[model samples]
Target: MIIGVALGMMAALLAAVEVTATVRPDVVIGLVIGVPGVLGMLMILMSSRRWVTAVGAMILAIGPGWFGALTAIQVASGV
Candidate 1:
């Protein structure tokens, strides 16, 4: 749960920053629409039982992490 939340927060920051200057519309759209839902789902799953909560958080984290990574790459490469 901790790891998931940490990673998710980190990714969200990256995505948010990327959204500010990124030319890719999809990246902006995904971060705008998908991230909040994923984070909300992660928060909701915090109340679930043991393994379920952990799995849920991780799953939610991974989804947006990819877009964040892509955006980060674009920012890094100045593409």
Candidate 2:
């Protein structure tokens, strides 16, 4: 559960960085998205409990869009 949370957080940060780098080519989106995703998948793969693996997969699937909505809200409110 803890590893899932950490990976989810890392994924969120990577996604945010990817969005930020869209206007600037200096930042590499592939690297940002790939590394954490790979680590998260590895962690999920290593989990012995099926529930843990499911939760991690779900978190990886959902965390990005949820954080993206929050980020959108913040940007809209500022504008």
TM per candidate: 0.42, 0.38
lDDT of 1 at 71: 58
Q: Give the best candidate by lDDT.
A: 1
The residue ranges of model 2 lying beyond 4 angstroms of the native Cα positions read 1-39
Model 2, residue 74: C-alpha shift (Å): 3.3
lDDT of 2 by residue, 1-79 (tens): 4454455566656655576543342233344445546655876988899886776575554444444444564587683
User: In candidate 1, what are the lDDT values of residues 1-79, reduced to their tens digit?
Assistant: 4565556557657765665663567766576448656775866566557666666666565555555556566698797
lDDT of 1 at 49: 75
Question: What are the runs in model 1 whose C-alpha is more than 4 Å off?
Answer: 1-24, 31-48
- Which ten residues in a row are the worst by lDDT in model 2? 21-30
Model 1's TM-score against the true structure: 0.42
Cα lDDT, all candidates: 0.62, 0.56
